[model samples]
Target: MLIQKVRFERSPKLHAMMTEAPYPVNARVVVQGKRGPEVATVRDEAEPMPGDGRYGMILGAASEADLDRWAELGREAEDLKWLLRARARARGLPVKIVAAEFTLDGSLLTVSYSAEERIELGALIQDLRGHTRARINFAAVGPREQAMMLGTLGACGRENCSSHHLQDFAPVSIRMARDQQLPLNPEKLSGPCGRLLCCLQFEHTQYLDLLKDVPRKNARVCHDSSGACGKVVKLHPLEGTVDVLTDAGMMQGVPASELRVLKGEPAPGQQKNRPRD
Candidate 1:
């Protein structure tokens, strides 16, 4: 048995496998998957001598003839996509087909889609089988996975994280944005996946840690040199500054290092925007 990592569109990363032998990168191989004999491209080397009684064996490496057939199927897949969409509309299936993948031998084709909930596509499956004469499998994906599978560009005008380098999705929430003092606008905070931007979670811990040094808005503070009591109207966490509203109604933006606060308040670990007075 040879060890290999194979790529399947349904999976986020390469699926682990113990196949017949090592296949060169880009070489297509047949492997038994949960659905049936599936086609996958050899992506990278894997651990040798892995005990894979649970993993499916690589049916075989593709021959030149099989490669020719694989190319033919690629052309046919496009037509199949249009046919599948038309059939879905006819049957009134509430799903949006995202992508399709076929095995190297063209014996099976997996159709991936996005839907609000589980959908029964038995009739649509039968129609697809009749048109392609191949075993049909259905995979449901979320908005993020749909963007990843289709390699969609995000609101940033760049390829989305899932499609580029992000291998997995981490839960993102509006809290992260608030913690970072970001504006709460949905358009600014959401990505192409219709979810919070993944970048919000990247430095959250650091932001929190930095925030420990900054005095919070609306807290009472004192100036080091002037000894004037003021209410913290804003903080600039990154710049290490605070905007203060003095008892005399004067506004002063001073470095965090120069600001002092009550005993129980946070140390100026970082700066933040001032809160509205």
Candidate 2:
């Protein structure tokens, strides 16, 4: 029989699952992991996954005995997190324990936490070893990762996108905001992660394309029918309107289609850091 590949349903950072076989969704099964067999649900239909000898397999749907054992492990892991958190707090460690998970066989407890910066944990790990016979694994994550592991609400008045569905973060910069004519205020543009908002990347491409047909701010323009000239003061892209400072000393908003560029060289106040269209 041909062996097929499958991935267990769960966040890769929080729970590791991969390997071979075809299985139906919601089928509880145990796969031989590095430490021991662990319980995981058949997340979805199986698909092929290329591997270099680091894959685990689905032994089969979990038995009643296996389910009982998994429940016991969950309670134990919760207790472990509490203990570790108390100890770290007592030592004045700058860390927030997000979660703790036990290896299927109970040989190890993987503790996840977030820290502002790196700090020595050698002494703490050693102390944990002496306290618990089982080995402990420490995983450090950033603020966004912490929220994803734990969960958080965003300024958008909803559950954070990262925690709920944003699996991968893309690079965002001030340029994205500039391209969209958004206020460059950091507080308004940043997300709960203290980084640029993830949504900034969404409409950037549309803004870039819209800018091609728009004239830059302070560019000289004239009404084709009346031959009255003016310098562009502002542009409302979605409205298809342009505010112009007419040579007659009046500022008026007019349809973009009625205006033609008076100069072909360049517009004043056009900079990579400041583009108004």
Candidate 3:
């Protein structure tokens, strides 16, 4: 048995499954998904692992009729989305319907939604079940997942990373923005998902590597090139430069290589006797 990575049309993550024979990349195949047999596109070949049975099996390549049925199911799912929204509105529910998907056999209907807080969906599910013969399942998603489902554009005018090629969301923190010397404003720092921008982590490690040897802002230092002692006012990590305010009150952009930390005096905000990294 061989293993391959496949991706469902409505999902962002790739799934590993066991296939009896090799399949070319991007080939449409029917696989045993959580909802039952469903159409998925082959992403790539995956290395076989021990106990691959838990990953499920690829039933076979999708037939022409299977492809047609998949398309038809997509249209039906779209129609179902509007019905779900209307039903939720009638019940005064706070959920926003993001997407709807159906299994290949139409045995299961999965609905993805976003909400400000946890919502009791027992009544809503009951009402939906009454209207459709297929079993209904509701999935609650966070802001980032909602953005991924909607396929929104980011500030850079490109498709969102979460919606594009990012297989998983990495942990992003406000400390990343602060380390990069970015403005703390929420609007500028946030992506379309209203969370910290995912790109903040892209160059973060590079910035950390550059700043490791450089003195912190407002730290007392002496410039070797001009032999002038001054305080570091700003850092240009990418350029390997620092702006120093000299004792004569003149500002000069000095290379980080030429500046050495002055002894005993700490950076303005730093505590005494504590060594700065």
Root-mean-square deviation (CA) per prediction: 4.1, 4.3, 3.3
Candidates 1 and 2 compared: the better one by lDDT is 1
Runs of candidate 3 exceeding 4 Å displacement: 50-53, 265-277
| True lDDT of residue 12, candidate 3 | 67
Clashes of 2: 1
Maximum-lDDT candidate: 3
The 0-to-1 C-alpha lDDT of every candidate, in the order given, reads 0.77, 0.71, 0.83
Where does the lowest 10-residue lDDT sum fall in candidate 2?
1-10
Instruction: Name every residue pair that clashes in candidate 2.
Output: 28-62
Please tell me which predicted candidate would have the highest TM-score against the true structure. Answer: 3
Model 1 segments more than 4 A misplaced = 1-12, 18-66, 264-277
Listed per model in order, the count of residue pairs whose N, CA or C atoms clash below 3 Å is 18, 1, 0
Ranking by TM-score: 3, 1, 2
